[model samples]
Target: MFQFLKRDPVKKLRKAYDAKLEEAMHAQRNGDIRGYAMLTSEAEALWQQIEQLEKK
Candidate 1:
């Protein structure tokens, strides 16, 4: 019944992953290695979650 009102977790994760990648790129370009690495790791985790959701 309320399925239409529910948001897709994968879709949300994908969006967040994209944003993280973009931020990571900016951080790298700014020479913030630590920030870049952190964001990259976060993005990778989100990718893993997205993959798990896709496998279902």
Candidate 2:
């Protein structure tokens, strides 16, 4: 039954991206511009890393 399973390397990265995006949005609501920007940057970096993994 487990034969259909496949490794999803990008899944964790996508989850991290989503989490960071939410953090950024929450920080924005709190008027923490610096924190929001940092989280957004982190999310973008994670996405880039995930994209790069496809080249391997």
Candidate 3:
């Protein structure tokens, strides 16, 4: 079975979510509150997607 070779969407999305959080952290550190909020929102969206996928 080649199921093991298939790419996992959840895993991919989680990686993106982590990246977004890191970016948001950097933005906050740089005093860009707007950028940080935007990035954090995007990361939250990604987390929602991951949750939906896991529910399937």
Candidate 4:
């Protein structure tokens, strides 16, 4: 029984944002413009999520 997994949505979103931000920058450097754009969108969405979570 793995009951120790805490549900921290904000933390989860922050991790995702950080990862996506880094990924976006990397993609931009690697000539994958589309991947960079998509990842940037994901990062923006994550920031929006963080804002919403903070409002709650």
Backbone clash count for every predicted candidate, in the order shown? 0, 0, 0, 0
Point out the worst 10-residue segment of candidate 3 by lDDT.
1-10
Residue 27 of model 2 has an lDDT of 100
lDDT, candidate 2, residue 5? 93
Candidate 1 per-residue lDDT, tens place, 1-56, comes to: 89999999999999999999999999999999999999999999999999999999
Q: Rank the candidates by TM-score, best first.
A: 3, 1, 4, 2
Q: Which structure among the candidates has the greatest lDDT?
A: 3
Model 4 clashing-pair count: 0
TM-score winner, 1 or 2: 1
Expressed as tens digits, the lDDT of each residue in 1-56 for candidate 4 is 66668788999899989999999999999999999999999899889999999999
lDDT of 4 at 39: 96
**Model 4, which residues run further than 4 Å from truth?**
1-6
* Model 1 lDDT, full chain set: 0.98
Q: Local error of candidate 4 at 34, Å?
A: 1.1
Task: Give the Cα lDDT of each candidate.
Answer: 0.98, 0.91, 0.99, 0.94
Give me the displacement of residue 21 in model 3, in angstroms.
Answer: 0.1
User: What residue runs in model 1 are displaced by over 4 Å at the alpha carbon?
Assistant: none
Q: Which is superior by lDDT, 1 or 2? A: 1
lDDT-based ranking: 3, 1, 4, 2
TM-score of 1: 0.90
